[model samples]
Target chain A: MTVDVGICSTDHVNAEVYAALLSELPDANLVGISGESRERVRKQANSVGAAAMSHQELMDAADGVVICSTNAAHKALVDLALRNDVAFLCEKPLATSLATAREIRDRCAESDVVAGMAMPIRYSRPMRRLKEQYEAGAVGELIAVSGVNRGRMPGGWFVDPEQAGGGAVADHTDHIVDIVRWITGEEIEEVYAETTTRFYDIPVEDVNLLSMTLSNGASFIMDGSWSTPQKNSFWGDADVELVGTEETLAADCFGYRYDHVSDTGHGRHTESIYWGADPNNALLRDFVAAIRGESTLAAAATVDDAVRTAAVIEAAYESVERGEPVDVDR
Target chain B: MRQIVAVGPETAVRAHVERYDRFDDAAIAGLVGVSEACADGIGAPRYESVSDALRETDADGVDVCGPGAVHGDALREALDAGVPARCDPPFALDGDAFDGLVSLASDGEGWLTAYSPHRFSRLYDRLRTDVDAGAIGSIGVARIKRTAPFDGAGWNSSYAGISAAADPVDALCAVLAHDADVLEWTFGAVERVFARARSGGRYDHVHAMFAFREGGRATIETTWSDEWTPEPRVDVEYSGNQGRLHFDEHDTLTALRNGGDHGQVAPPGDDCRGGALRAFLERIEGEERPPSAVDPEGPSRAVVAVRRSVAEGRPVTLTEEGSR
Candidate 1:
């Protein structure tokens, strides 16, 4: 069935959603654009050739929707989408707070709607190869992994505590946490985190180190800090190295790049242009395939994964507060 | 020039002798085998014991290139005689031996240090300089990874202390001294450790996390894999509040800016290939060299803590004195 997809909210994430949808699903109809601001919605709708509509109207009319709103607004939008029996794809975090995330997850379970969470990292070429290699026994029984997902602190609503939820720990922690679990086929059993606010004066922490133990007794420590520079630098990274009984393997999804230094954009800056396959394209392709009932979303994250990772992230915050290790809420 | 006696098995002493070929200020004077009787140790006069070798030869320093088992005794024999000596990693097999050697080294007229190709490599020398100068700022996390081909036969035969008879986990911990030494030199003493190890058929892989006394943390992963490689993987990464520093070899260092740009590399340097023997001789010759090998006291304690952590299946805390 050809699906009519509407995008709800064109706030911070609206551009990527529009670009990715068109790049991956060229023939798919973008029927509606909805947001809190009518003017912004109208402008984005015109730009993307989508019709501006209310969130309720968009949900009722379109077969599915993509919510790129701020972190806190996810649950409400998801509730509306589920009530209309409209399938939807939510961004990185399902919701801001764990309580809100759990409520959204439960609501998702009760509905027959096709829901997906945007964890595009697993779709990267290097990460996909890393997972395939592990499953192919490239390394024997994997015992430990050390991963880093460091990014520049994106200012604006991302730094806003209520809008983006937490700081670096929240924003940066999700990608590698999702990768580690997805690649290794193991759930994080516990987490011990030490967090600090550095590089950015935002109300949230920009640096965080989390030592996590996997369900199979293997362990990994992820340095998921938003420590990159926003200007004159490559955006961020998702790199991991795993050790197993027979061998060791490493992958950097964003590592293959052409380093260029020139008096360009920001005046005398060095940045790497990553020539790797765009992960967002792959993620949206899988989401669209699942929405059209053509295939299951093996390449994209489902709503349940969002809840589990939220539990880990929530426990990490708790562990930092308690100054000790905390059991991941399963 | 300094003449050091290579004390160990033929294979072990030859490893030290080979390093001497690259040094200008040092030469292997003689050899003393630990267990088996060895003839002409690669043209150097072979002796029965450390005392006998020192008693007969004009050797001024001792190089305990023996297995982990005899490192404590051979290095002790020289240091106690007020002779500057260097030994292969672990320095000692057990806590008592380690404590004894540390005490003697502190009081000895001649200095003592451990021998490692990596620590003495031009690679780490420059990195150590950068780290000491805070080029990357105050680092909160440092990760070190080492992987080499597991020499199963040689480990069982020559390395007695770390032979399969010992607890495999402890044996592996004993071998991780070089990695621990790097951490100790860069960061200060580790206050606590949480270690986990796995054995396929041989206990050859382990992951150990350290909480530094100087307000930082580190993860050290060492693996002796079944696959063969021309060179071992040596990855050292330091994540600081300001910037990050990472390197795997002597030629280049990928320096990340305060807001990290991963592709940045420091300019290549003049081939500054300093060896352990050269470092020891420089200290004996009193040249006031920059950044010699650190005291093995901290690394020894870390090994002990890692062993205990693996044994207890929990995190082990190290006190100022030792493992608590």
Candidate 2:
């Protein structure tokens, strides 16, 4: 059976990428698109040969939904999908805060609809190999883990506190935290963070660092900084290095590409060499397969995992405010 | 010309001799070790203790390369003898010990400093220059990662010869001494520290977060494990309002501004040990006061605070008054 998918809120940066990936899947049908702006939704829908339907009509017709709206609108869209008993692939940070994330997770857990968080790092080939090596004891018992998610400060609504919920700490913390949680299979017990608006004149912080201890007693550090300047070719890096008893492993989730120097508007701009599979496409493929009931949600982040990450981010923000390490509320 | 007595195990003393030989103006006058085993393979006159070296060497300065626990007594003896001294990191065990040594140096006709080669590194010099010039605006965050290969035989043997050989805390402090110096030099005084340390037998790894008193944050992650990188991995990045400066292990510094101006800055020079030795010799000649760059007390107190944070499992705050 074809799994009908609808794009809710076609205005996000990932909306087009998701639409294109869904259109390529054989068993997945891009049924419709809905957003706050009808004109943009129609244009986005027409680009992918899908109809621009009202929010409720799209929810009623699609078998599954992809929530690609701003951070503030995630909970309401997920609520609509849950009410319609349709599965969903909510964008990263299942919700803006812990309360909403937990509420959404609980509702999804009580309902029959499948809920997955869009954390593409779990699907990256290098990350998968690293996780396999950890499980196979290539690195003995995990002792410490550190990662970096240093992307350029994403402007637009991302810098808007009202729409984005927060800045670098809010947008970038969950990906590495979720990846570490996935690799170690341990929950974060405490978080200490420091954030500043040092990189850009944005309303929220563009540089954030988080130090955490996992339940297994391993220490973790994350540099979730939007410190990458535009002069660099690539957008940013998502790399993790793990130190274990027997050995250590370091993986750059996006390091499989080549580098090119282009003489563009700027004298010299470094660009990424994309030589491997796209992680976003891999994530969409898994979402389609799960929606088709052909696979389990083990590889994908569940709503519960999102709540856990949200809790950690919450604790990190609190630590930043209090100038001390704060315990993660389990 | 200046004559320097080296004190430590054979390996550490030999390393200091090699560094001194690189400088034309300084020579190793004598060697001091705890036993004949500690003096093995050394061609210089070997003394049984720091006091013996001080009495017999006729040296202008002393270089203390002993274990972390004995650094205080070594420095005290060198200062009391009216000879300037250069010691390795974890210069003292605690703040009180550090202050006492500083007081001795102040009262005596001698100067004291710590060996922090990174402060003399050309890359660090450029970054410091840029920060002082407000090229990166007000500093918000800085990160430094230093990872070295785990030499099981080297650390196991050296640590075993120390008096506090069984204390893991002392061993880890000695390993992280240089890191503490780098943190204090770049970020100013660290007001607070929270650290998590792990050990895999021979090598210990520490990941620490710092809250600088000057309203900024920094992190230092140092590991001496068997992670085989082609070379030593060191990366330092500073983030500020106007731009960012990055120094990779390749000995290259890149400054990227927010408005699209990007360029590479040439490093000042290498031979941090050579520069440090010259500074020590100059201090011995009364050509200058203790070079502020090599002040041993700042790093000593920082190391003490970091150790306290790790042992207590909480953030340890270092007030200026308390540290002094």
Candidate 3:
């Protein structure tokens, strides 16, 4: 049977990406799209060759719902998905705050619904290879890990604190945090962070750096900055470096590039050349497989994983406020 | 020409001598080590002790490169002989020892200097120049990482044991002192420090967080693990209000400006030890002053602060009273 999937909030950046990927899944069908604006949702739905339905209607009709709404809308949409007994893939962060993320996680655990967070970096081929080598002791016992996720300041609701939850720390931290946990199989135990809003006039921060200690005696540093300028040739960078007892490994999550310099209006551009499978399609395939009971959730970000990331991020924010390292509530 | 008595037959000492020999103005008059066999490895005249080398040779200065514990005694001997002295980091065991050396150097006519080869690297120099030039604006955060292959022989020393005459943590701190000096040079005086350290078998690791007096922050992570390749890995990054600057062991300097302007600068030459030795000789000639290239006092205090933070299980403030 086809796994019917509906996307909420067509305005989200990943909504169309998910819609396109889901439509390509052999056993998955994009049933409908819903958002706060009917006209916008209808336009996105028509463009993706799906039906535009109300949020309640979409929840009732789909086997799995993809929550692509703004940060503030995740709790309600997740609640609706849980109420309808549907498997859901919520965007990263799981929720706006630690309490809300935990509530969603706990509620999902208590139910039979399959839930995952949309963490595409974990599914990327380079990151997958790095994780495999690290787990196989190719780099020896893990000693430390560092990551950089520098991207252009995402405008729109992302800059609004109420809609996005926090700034660069909230928007960019969870992905790398989840990746570190997934690679090392360790949870973050404490965090010391510093944040600043230096680049933009927005209320939220654009630069954040977090120093974290893992449960397994490994230290981590993450640079989550929206400092990429508009004039850059590429979107930004997502890279990770892992140091171990015998060797060191570094993976550029988006480093496979093919530069194109044309005299047309677009000028120079550096296109990221993904070698094999598309990460989004891989995530969708796994989600479909999990919903069909064909396989258990493995590499995909699970509910607990989402909550752990939220906890680290929450502790990071607290560290920023306290001006010291704060213990993470696991 | 300035004739120098080189102390120790360690690889670091030999490397420094080899680099310094490239310069025509400095000459190694003798090689001193605890054992004559060790000193005989070098081409220069072999001596069993620093005093023997200084007493028998017309040396103008001494380069102390023995184990960290001997640094204080070597410097005292050099200062007593009234010769300029240069040593690597972890120059003294504690602040009091460092202060005593500082007083000796002040009273004597010979200059006292410490070698921090990383600071002399062309890439590191460029980073300092860029930051001072306001290329990246005011620094908000700085991070430095150093990882090297573990040498089991170093762990055999009682100093490396958990219960030694001195704190075993100092063994790791000695390696990290240069990094701490770089942090101080790039940012400013660290006002506070919190750190965590672990040791296993022949390896040790330390992760420290520093809050600077000028409102910036820094994290320094150093490790001597068996897993790293033969070539050591070093990385320094400075994130500022207007941009970011990064330098790595690959001799690459990457600058990311706020408006999306990215530039990679690679300076020529990898002769960091040569640069440091040249600086030392320059200081000996009265062309420079004490604390040239690397300040022994700053890194000494940083090590103490890190050790205290680890021992007290709290951040150590760097104020006048708290540091004491």
Largest TM-score belongs to which candidate? 2
TM-score per model for chain B alone?
Answer: 0.76, 0.79, 0.80
- Alpha carbon deviation, residue B27, candidate 2 (Å): 2.6
Assess each model's interface with DockQ, reporting 2 decimals per model.
0.20, 0.38, 0.18
lDDT of each: 0.71, 0.75, 0.74
Give the best candidate by lDDT. Answer: 2
Instruction: State in Å the error of residue A304, model 2.
Output: 0.5
Where does the lowest 10-residue lDDT sum fall in candidate 1 chain B? B264-273
TM-score of 3: 0.82
Candidate 1 lDDT, tens digit per residue, B1-324? 788888765655655566576667777677877433454436778777787888888887887663343456677778778777766466664567766777776766656766443465456667788889987677666777766443321111123223322445555665576668777877777887777676663226677878787767777877654334424456677776667777663333233434432332322111211255566666677754224332566777788777777666566778866675
Q: Rank the candidates by lDDT, best first.
A: 2, 3, 1
Which scores better on TM-score, 1 or 3? 3
lDDT of 2 by residue, B1-324 (tens): 788888766555665566677666777778876356545555577776677887876898888764444656777788888777876666676667766776788787777777566566565677788888987777777877766542322111122223332454565566566667766776677887777787774345778777777877788887664334323566778876667788764543134333542332322112554455566676777765665423656667777777777777777788765442
Error of 3 at B48 (Å): 4.2
Q: Model 1 compared with the native: what TM-score?
A: 0.82
Better of 1 and 2 by DockQ: 2
Against the true structure, candidate 2 reaches a TM-score of: 0.89
